[model samples]
Target: MRVIIVGAGEVGRSIASNLEQSHDVVVIDRNPDVVEGLTYSLDVLALQGDGTELGTLRAADVAEASLVIACTDSDESNVVVCGAVKTVSDAFTIARVRRRTLLETWEGSQGAFGVDFMVCMDLLTAQAIFRISGLPATQDVDTFVGGLVRMAEFEIGPDSPVVDTTVQEADRYDSLTFAGVFRGEEMIVATGDTLLKAGDRVVVIGSPGSVTDFADDIVTPSAEETDEIVIVGASEIGFQAAREFEEHGYRPRLIEQDHDRAREVAEALPNTLVMESDATDTEFLAREHVDEADVVIAALDGDEKNLLVSLLAHRLGVDRTIAVIENLEYTELFETVGVDVAINPREETAEEIVRFTRAEQTEKVAMLEHDRAEVIEFEVGPDSVLAGEPIAAAATDLPDDVVIGAISRSGDLMTPRGETVIEPGDHVVVFVDAAVLEDVLEAI
Candidate 1:
């Protein structure tokens, strides 16, 4: 399949990189430098031109493309690019926008602007914040198979009870499958003998209840109940996050430095307490008793400001500090410097758009640890290698890094084991190394 992607920003670049090995990928960018860089770095065709122009679409051979993704920085540009693609090609089109209003409008209009699908970056980031904040030690969270299965990345704290235990010993939960572990720069596929060390980010896939149980167990067993939730910033993401918390029965406090923005958010979210004050102000934070808040989220506009707010909240005795970062490079840096979680909107948008491109047979996908590995869900077709075969036999054909995480049959979650026979139509979730993702997707 030929996939044409517009905009050479992080989201577009990420999608191109993930699909280049499996599909014929074309990337269009206005920046000549980015085009030249992608030409040499990736195995995809890179063109220097505006994506919304007819001449550029002709040059990209859009008619032959199977999918076209518009991910430019400007929402208008992305929508226009998708609209332009529809004029020339029958390809599936995806547009990445940052505004919730646009997403709602697109949804209400039944795929308006000729966009086959749309991804809202701010809304996805806000939802990601809510998911990560719900679990105690989670750095990332994604649900698959209609929420029947959950994949979570949790940082094993230094004082956690499961620290220093092997995968065999730590496999105490029912219906949970240890998928992979990220220790420093190494991505270790889970095995019975693999040791669980403190600070290691472990990825697990299983039923939602089991994942939640594992989450609570990995923490040091907190006795203190969460009383207050504070979100710092009235940025698009911050406002959406406050609203998400409110919808889920939490009356969160939102702090915005701008008076007008605070008043608007207060009016919009009646259940939320919107305050106008500088979150970084020590006196203001102290006066408002921000130190007592169990969770503090820094959703400021700038990366520097978010970092400052998260650090300040940490200093003020906040148990968890989540920050929204625009630069993907700052995720590790921010987390290393004491931030609990760094939510990158571009990364989340890229993951969502990339997942849409794999609907041929794959049902869903969750990218892990910056695409070092992936957890994919797909139905076992009649011709699939896993169909009518035990997992132990199927494992021989799969890559060594692959793990049969979990399988669901007839709406029932089935934990994959060596002796378990996978049948046709069974929705199986598998963990695969990114290096062998193309091969796994082809076989499964």
Candidate 2:
């Protein structure tokens, strides 16, 4: 497939890198330096030009492209680029946006910008942060099949009950599967004899109930009632997180260094307590009793500032620290430095755009172990190989690294057993090692 990606920034470069191996990818940017860097770093074709210009799109052969993605930092530019592509090509278009207001406006009026899909980074990041808060121990959490299936990554704490136990012994949940374990930098395909150790990040897949139960067993659960929440920035990400917390019946205190922006956000959020104060000020945070807060979100615009605030909150005894990191390189650094969770909007946007480019049969895809494995959800079509067949029969032919985690049928979710029969229209969730993704996709 021929794909054209607008913007040579982090999100655009990420999408280009992911698709260049399997498809023809062309990237456009106005900066010659960025295009040159992309050309040297990636196998994709890099063109220097304004993405919103007709001549540039024509030169990129947009008309013959299978997909066109607009991921420029500016929302208006992304929308205009998608609109321009629609005028010249019938290719599917996706626009990366950051504002919920623009997304809502475009969504209310179907296809307002000629965009077939919109990836809202702020909303996606907010949702991810919210999920991490719900499961305080997980490094990441994603749901599929209408929330019936959940995929979570958790680090085995030294005090965890499952630590030092073999995979077979820890397999107590009827619906849960220990997909894989990341021991340091290496990913180990989990087997019956595989031993789970402290500090190993384990990826688990199954129904939401089973995953939660397993999490409780492996990690200390947070308090039952979370009455206090603290937000260290009044930026868009911070505002969105606070808004989501409010929907869950928690009032959050938002602290901003800029008085004008704080006042603006205060007026915008009626249920939140907005304060004009620098969050890095230890005296101010201590006076506000931020250390006792249930959760502290560091969502300042600057990644450095977010890291600093998160570290400060952690020192002050905040229960959980979630930092908004724009640079993907800083994610592991944040986690290593004690940040409970780090949300990267650019990575999230790239993942969403890549999902659209996957095989048409794939309904959802979640990258795991830094893209070394994927948990994919798709409906079993009438012609699918597994349709109307018992899972045990199908398991015999599947790669040992691949596991059928769960299935949702007629709005009911169940952990798949050997006797479980797959039927047409059933949503099947499978965990496939990245090396076997193509083979699994072929079989399905």
Candidate 3:
């Protein structure tokens, strides 16, 4: 497959990175520096030019590509690039568009504009945070559904009280099942006598509320004093998020683009300072004393704008810097760019859709590296060879790079060692890298 990516920045680079692994990839950017650096470092073809120009699209050979992605910082540029690509070829086009105003206007006209999919990073990231925060006890929550079910991770801190207890005993505390534990460099499936030591990372799946309560118990056995958090952005979604932060006792300082809008938002939200200034202005951020804040949440409506503000916060050395990204395509770039957290609402929403679509075929599914790698969950059927076999026995049949995470039979969860038996009707979770997903599925 051939893929053409526009915008060599974080989101563009991320899309290129994923597609390049399995396809013929080419990237075009107006900035020569970004093109040279990313292309050389990533070993993908980079062309220097404007994506919206037909000549540039032809130079990149977009006509032969199966997929074309417009990831430029400017929504207008992305739309124009997609329009030009579609005019030249019948390939699928995905555009990164971050403005709510555009969404309200475009409503259902994106197809007419030649865009197959539109990514809104701010709304997506905010939705991700909101979905995770719904399970407040869980340190990190990755939901396969919008909210129907969740996979939550919890850190066993020093004061977790159950730190030294066995997995079985710990399971009795809350009704949540102990799926797996990450200890140091090893992954262990939970067992009756498996000891839960401090610093052990536990994975669990359950309803959102129950998961949050369970996480709260594991992370902070005792009540924790809420810390202050500063959120920058006064957009509608930003205002909604400010309410959530304030409700948690966070000292929130919201900055808007205009004075009148700021005053109006301030009138609606008490105990929150709503001032007027662009988040990209470092002087305004520092003058507002955002540098001293415990955590800075950048909920700007634009991906590039949020990125710039996030970098500023990082440069200023904030304890935490979280940016709202709607584009699921750029998720990996967050890690590569050293951004603490990249939240994508569309990615989260799309995940929910994909999970719903594949719920019956697999026990569970997790999209890794921006949906490039698919983690599948399966239950051993009554007649499958996996039934009644030990983990070691299954290991011999399974190919390399496949890890059997956990087993649950008759509501009892067990960490499978090499000797552990997989009885019929057992539910199991497996981590399958993208390269071997098909073989892994066939083996299970």
Candidate 4:
């Protein structure tokens, strides 16, 4: 399928790279330099043009495109790009937005901006923070099948007891399936013989309870319990995060430096205690007893500021520190210095938009370890190679590393085994190496 992507920035480049391996990808940017850089860096065709204009869209061959993604920095620009695309072609359009209100508006009226789907970056970051906070020692977390199934990635720490244990030996949960293991640059599909390494990030999928049970067992028994959540800054992501916690029965504390913003958030979030003060004020943090908080999230306006806040909270004795880092390059630096987790909005936006570009049967997708592998949910069609065949018999036709994580059929969950027969219309969640994603998707 021919795919056209607007905005050749980090997020746009990420989407282009993901789709380039399996589909026809074209990237557009107004900056001639950026377009030229992409021309050399990625295999996609790079065009120098404004995405909001019809002439530019036509030059990119929009008529023959199957998907168009509007990911310019400006939300208004992205919506307008999608709107402009609709005037010319019937390609599926997706827009990446930063504001919650815009997302809510589009959600209230599906396809409001000629966009078939919308990915809200800040909102996705907030949701990711909440999910990672709920799980213990998780590197990543995502849900599928209307929340009935959960996929989690946990790094096997050097101190973990299961570091050297094989997948089947450590996986004793009845409903949990070891999906895949990421060891540096290699992705190993989970199997009875696959051994868990200390630095490996292991992916698992199953019932939420079973996944949580597995998480609890792999982490240190003395891991701090998340009883208190402190959010620094009143940025949109921070506000949404506090709201998310409140909706889940958590009365979290929010600290905002701006008086007006703090007051507004306080009014909107009655359950959250909004404190108007500089988050970097060490004296204020001490006075508020921030040292006793279990989890501290830094969502300040600047990446460096968030890093400072996260480091400060870590020094204040917070058990965990999560920071929103805008620049992708700083994610590793922040984590290495002291922050427990670093959330990148661009990466999250790319993950959300790439799912729609997959095969027609793909229902949902969750990228793990920065897209080195993916856990994808897809419906089995009658024409599928796996349909009406035992999983063991069909296994020979699929990529050797593909792991069927979970299956849902007729409102019931099934733990797939060698003898399990895959029928039509069944929603199967599979963990596959990104190298063979197209191969697996085509076979299924």
Candidate 5:
């Protein structure tokens, strides 16, 4: 597909970097420096101009392009760019709007205006942070189609109401379903009679309202408060992650290999402890109490180095170890090697870009795993034929490789079994083990 991207920040560059591999990508930026940086690393065409200018859109040949993505830092600029693109192109258009107010309503004939979708970067970042922190015992929440349906993760607190409950009993909740359990670091596919245990992270699926109710049942804060999280890199993205974590009350200790870079990061983060040291050194890690840290975040610039540090930290018994991997291709291997969570900023950015460029019908995939076969969550419409059918019955119609792992209905969640019925208002969480996602959706 021919795609045009506006802006050249992390997100815009990311979109270009990702799509350039499989489709034709052209990036436009006002800043010469940003354009230079993109040109150096990517095979994308770089156009220097104000993204909001109609002339720029015409110059990029938007009329013949498959998609146009406005990803400038200013939401208003993106909106303006989209408006301009609409005047010349019938291509799908996505605008990156930062404010929640802009997304409150989908106005102005998006199809007619050449704006088929909008992305809120801050909201996406906040959502990711909240999931990592496990707010109110909610470990994670993956949604499909702007909350039409969602998969929520609930940590079984020591005092959880469902402590002694069986999965079957939990499934009996009117509007909720239990999908899976994260025992230690493993994700267990839930069964009707599976028993809840303290410290287990349970995944539930339902509508927003139903998911909240289910969370209230089992969400509980951890027994131990995390006082410090050791960050093993001080790159721009690493610093951003550290800042986000700090905002949520986690104490950050940033380590950098370069002395000058360490000093720079130290000055920028007034609250964080900056250490000038090589994270790959076990002795250095030991001196910093890396093993005793509540969490270890390896945001190293090198994927191999990050993987090594994370594996070492995990072996030393750190409660949780996260790694920011540069290579999206190595994510599964990293996960299998004991990295609790592998984050790729480029991948995240690309997913958002794809969602916007493809129109709202494309699932906004934040993370991919199991060779892109098993996605986190997917959204379907209420009018979907999958609605109002029992899960077991729905299973046969879906591709054999796909499974309805969970469902969200009226703000409640269900770890659905074949006997469980899907309703029109329900959002089904499917786990597909193949790339036949479109086939699965069609079957539904």
Candidate 6:
């Protein structure tokens, strides 16, 4: 597929990097330096021009493109680019916008801006954080198969019950499968004999309940109750997080520095406590007993402020800290500085958009091991290579780095064994190393 990406920002670059491996990708940016950098770093075509301009789109050959994604920082620019692409091409258009109001308008008008799909970064980031909060000790969480299956990453601590056990010994959950283990920099395709260590980051795929149970058993248990969620900043991200938590029976306290914004959010969310105060103020945090909160989410607008709030919360003895970082480059830095989890809105939005560009057989895709591996959910078609064959027979043809995590048939989720038969219409979850993604796709 030929894909044209507008704006060479973090999200645009990420989308291009992910797509260029399997599709033709062209990236456009107004700045020459960004275009030069992209050309030097990524395997995609980089063009220097304004995406909203007609001449630029024509020069980029939008008419023959299969997909066009507009991800400029300005919502208006992105919408205009998508609309312009639609005027010239029959390609599917995806617009990345930060404002929920714009998304709602487009949805209500049935893609008025010519956007076939829209990604709201703030909402996606908030949803990710909410999911992580619900699952104990999970760094990331993604759902697939209509929410019937889940993929989660958990970091094992020294005190974890499953730290010293082999993968087979720790396979106590009936509906869960140990997908892979990331030990420092190496990703190991987990087998029955794979030894789980204290610092290994393990990825698992299974039903939601089973994954949660496995995570709780493999990671050090937190005494923090699920209901005690504290959100710093009544910004859009914070408000969305509060709304999601409230829907899940959690009464979260939202703190905003602005008095009027706090009042507005309070009115909109009756279940949340809207407090008007500076979260960076130590006295205010102490008075409110923020340390007692189960989770402290730094959803402030600025990355620096969010980092500061996360550090403060951690210093105050908060068990977990989740920071909303706009800059994707700072995700690892935030984690290194003691934040339990760093949510990059741009990265999350890019991943969500890339899922739509995947092969038709792939139901969902989740990035793991810093994009070095992927957990992909695929449905077995009648003509698929694995259909009507036992997993053992197919395992010989599969790549060594790819492991079948779970198989769901007739609403039953199973941790597949070598003798398990893969039939048509079965939902199979596979963990694949990035190096063998294409081979796995071809085999399945």
Error of 5 at 239 (Å): 0.8
**What TM-score does model 6 achieve against the real structure?**
0.96
Instruction: Name the weakest run of 10 consecutive residues (lDDT summed) in model 6.
Output: 218-227
Candidate 5 local lDDT, 210-296, one digit each (tens) = 776666555444434456678788876567667777777766788898988988878878888989987878888887788888777
Models 1 onward score TM values of: 0.97, 0.92, 0.63, 0.94, 0.58, 0.96
1-444 per-residue lDDT for model 3 (tens digits): 777888877666655654455568889999899888976788589999999999999998888887787878788998898889988999888777767566556666647578776666545545555544443333346643334345666567667777899977876433355656667556665666889987676666655555666765665544442355667788666876776666666557887887888898899889788778887777887787777765667777787777777778878877456677756566557534755567665455444434433445575676543444454566787666577788888778876555565566666555556788888777776554556665666666
Give per-residue lDDT, candidate 1, residue 223.
25
Across residues 1-444, which tens digit of lDDT does each residue of candidate 6 receive? 899999988899888988888888999999999999999999999999999998999999999998999999999999999999888899999999999999889889986989999999888888988999987678888888788889999988779899789999998887888889998778998988999998788998888889877876765665544668999998899999999999888899999999889999999998999889999889999999999998999999899999999999999998889999887789878887788888888888888888888858498999875588999999888877789888889888888898888888888777788889999999999989988888888888
Residues 165-262, candidate 1, lDDT per residue (tens digit)? 99999999889999999999999999989999999999999999899888878887762445488999999999999999999999999999998999
Report the number of the highest-TM-score candidate.
Answer: 1
Alpha carbon lDDT of each predicted model = 0.92, 0.87, 0.67, 0.90, 0.68, 0.88
Candidate 2 per-residue lDDT over residues 1-444, each given as its tens digit: 899999989899978877787789999999999999998999999999999999999999999998999999999999999999989999999999999999999889998999889989998888777877777468888998888789999988777888899999999987898778888888887778999999898988888889988877787544443467898888899999888888887789999989889888888888999988989889998998999987888989999999999989989988778899988898889889888788898888888888888858599998875577888998888877789889989777678788887899998888888799999999998888887787787788
Q: Best-fitting candidate, measured by lDDT? A: 1
Residue pairs whose backbone atoms clash in candidate 4: none
Which 10 consecutive positions of candidate 2 have the poorest summed lDDT? Answer: 219-228
Alpha-carbon RMSD, each predicted model: 1.3, 2.3, 7.6, 2.0, 9.1, 1.5
Q: Per-residue alpha-carbon lDDT of model 4 for 1-444, expressed as tens digits?
A: 899999988899999988887889999999999988898888999999899999999999999998999999999999999999999999989999999899899999967989898999998999999999997778799899999899999877788889899987998998889988878768777889999988788899999989998887888777765779999999999999999999899999999989999999999999999999998899999999999987899998999999999888888788788899999999878877878789999999898888767646598999877788889998899998889989999889998878898999996889899999999999999998888888998788
By lDDT, the candidates rank as 1, 4, 6, 2, 5, 3
**Residue 244 miss distance in model 2 (angstroms):** 1.3
Better of 1 and 6 by lDDT: 1
Candidate 3 error regions (>4 Å): 137-139, 145-148, 164-169, 173-201, 206-210, 224-237, 240-258, 264-444
Residue pair clashes in candidate 1: none
